[model samples]
Target: MILSVALLVPWATGAVLVALDGRRRAVGWLAVAVLAATFALLAVLTAQVLAGGSQEVVTGGWPPGVGIVLHADMLGVVFALLSVLVLLAATTHEVLAGIEERVFPGLVLLLAGGLTGLFLTGDVFNFYVFFELAMTASYVLTAYGGGRRQLRAAMVFTAVNLLGSFIFLLSVAGTYRVTGTLAMLDVGERMAVVDPNAALLIATGFFIAFSVKLGLFPFHFWLPTVYAGSSPAVAAILSGAVANIGAYGLLRFGPTMFPAQLRLVGAAIVVLGAVSLIYGAVLAVARGDVAESLAYSAIGQVGYVLVALGVGGPVGLTAAVVYSVVNALNKTLLFLAAGIRGPLVAGAFAVGALSVAGVPPAAGFVGKLEMFRAGIVVGSVPLIVLLTLGSGLSLVYMFQMYQRAFWRAPAPAGPASPLPLRLLTTAVALLVLAAGVWPEPLLAASGRAAEGLLPGAAG
Candidate 1:
């Protein structure tokens, strides 16, 4: 029941809100109320699962062999919680700023529902179902501002992601053909016996699909245009919530279904990460536009996730999870803060900057600390050096953006932000600070999440 409510509540409310006037305060509040309720259910489900164990639900009460499986483990739960929190923050920021579009609130809820379903499902095909649910909404949401620039961004996003979706579906088809099963566990077991060549090809497909989603080096052409083109709320959702799909997909599919292939290309993956780290940071420092620089910085931040994945053990995977969470929180705060101005906004941006720089008392420091551990465990001197360079570059670009965006003498005639927007950003900033000060929960949760990939895995 808890599982069902967690999946259905946002979906049902979003369906109702699609036709309503979300610009009105009452309807906007309704959207927030629905998200809050859904979040509370997820919290309950998280506690339940932690106390007990993973929960599994097969639709139609059919056997696991015959029905779609919805499985919730620590990995799924932690990601779902993080995604919902980001959606809530972005939505609240939009609402408090006076929602302009009728579809803004509803689309966000639908995106939430889709994300929840995608994260929780155990069936790969069902994964595709929920993926589309979210991507379709996001494609539309990218066009939210309804201008030439927003529309063009939507077009690029849609075109590239559609091609990615096609690649993913083709891979799915091949997996079904070879393994004769869509259940992740079954696929994992069968993949060992499947033709090695076929498996490697399919793994490459999955890798490319996720890489495009993440905007990694070489496949990142669409990112800056889309991110800089979209409005702040939409940009936040894309970077903070939707981007998780790619990272989570790689973690789930690679280790569980394509472990051999992952190991085979682990070093290659690290090289790509290193290149992305260098390329993104260098370009970010050169870009003048605040959003564009952050877009490139985002490219760089994800390199750390790839680096940790390449390390390929319990410790490295744990570092990957921790950094992913921290990056999400940092990007969400920074993007939302970009839209608002007045007292306190500069402080909020500074917190985000310091976090990205991996400075103390921000969650990003903990993330980098874990990455350092991962690098040491792997005995990779190059990884350590690359990390140092990345950190220094991040500090340079972050302070550069802060100076230009926030520290420039107060705007002469710009609109002042409402208190709610200021308060929302401040709350997220404090959350980042608190996580750094007391990181036990983040560390433990990420450790447990990595354990899902290999139970009893030791660093």
Candidate 2:
């Protein structure tokens, strides 16, 4: 029941806010209260899980194989915590900016609910359902401000996601036809015995869908435009919260549900990730706008996670998990700070830029170091070389953006709107910095989460 409440509280609160209409300023505070309550609830649940206990709840008291099942495992808890914290920070920033319309907060809550559903779902078909829930909300949120560019970006974003969803549904149908069950764990066990031809088609479909969502190489066309056009707040959510779904899908389904297929497909994924790292870094160096540069940087950083996963070992997977969490926080801070100007904002950007570049003692460095260790563990010399070169390119582009944004003098005497500052916003930035400098706890959490997913590891 508590797990279910964690999933529903956000959507339920959003519904109340929507019913209250858009004019009331009190709705904003209500939204904050709802998320704060959610944070407290999640903390309790996380503590319970860490104490060697787990919870599972089936909707409508139906059987596990037949009904929607939500479970609180280590992996889900980590992501749920990340989602809640990021949304809290985003909501606070929006409120302080005086743009706290009812719809904005409502949509943020709705987005959080959808992600919760996605993370908690234990059934394959239910995963697709929650995936749609999250995607649909994200599509609308991306275009919430509704300008020409935003509308255009939203169209591309919607079309691509819808197509991906359709393909995912087709895969689900294929899997069901072969295995006759939608339970994720059961499907994984049965898939090897199913007809190879059908399995191949289904696996290909799932790969395409996940890759599209992750914005891998050729399928990533929608990302830059969408990031550039959306509000910085919305951009932070998309980059931080939404992008994790794709990585999660790959981590959850790829190894467990489609092991044979992953073995066949892993090299391609590794290649795509490497290409994205170099391509995105190069493009960032050429980009002029702050938002666009961060967008490209996100591509590169996510690529690192992909490459780590493609290595396909306990160490590699652990590194990927750590990288995903660290990258999400770092990217969110960078995108949020990109919207800021003035001396204080400049300092924020400098700190965030160094962190993103994998500077020493930051969270990003922990992830980078782990990734390098994983590459060595796998004995992949070429990958080691690529990772080193990728890190160098990342530093070059990140420092270039920093020099342009912070070091360059403001244009002489023409009036420009000053960047807003609020305590909540600064706190969020500092928290990210703190996590980077002292990341042992997050690293331990990520390692435990990865071990829970790995075969023959203690749960």
Error of model 2, residue 203, in angstroms: 2.1
TM-score of decoy 1: 0.97
Write one digit per residue (lDDT tens) for candidate 2, span 1-459.
678888889988876676664435567667778888887878878888878755778988897777789877777788888877888777766665655344777777887888888887778888888888889878887886678987887898899989999999999999999999887777888998988778878988987898788777767888899888888778888888888888888888877787777778788878988998888888888898877888888778888878987887778888888988888888777777676666666667666677777787667778889989988998999999988887888888888887776678464332123444434445666776788788887887887777766654432
Per-residue lDDT tens digits of candidate 1, residues 1-459? 788778888998898898999889888888888888888889888887777778889867898877767898888888999999999988888888778899888998999999999989999999999999999999999998899989999999999999999999999999999999988888888999999999999999999999898888878899999999999989999999999998899888888789888899999999998888889999999999899999999999999998888888899889989998999999999999886786787788899999999999999999999999999998889889999999999999999999888778456444334777888899999999999999998898888888888723321
Candidate 2 residue spans exceeding 4 A from truth: 22-24, 100-102, 409-422, 456-459
Flag regions of model 1 displaced more than 4 Å. 409-417, 455-459
lDDT of each: 0.89, 0.79
Task: Report how far off residue 294 is in candidate 2 (Å).
Answer: 1.3
Best by TM-score: 1
Candidate 1 global CA lDDT score: 0.89
Model 1: residue 405 alpha-carbon error in angstroms: 0.8
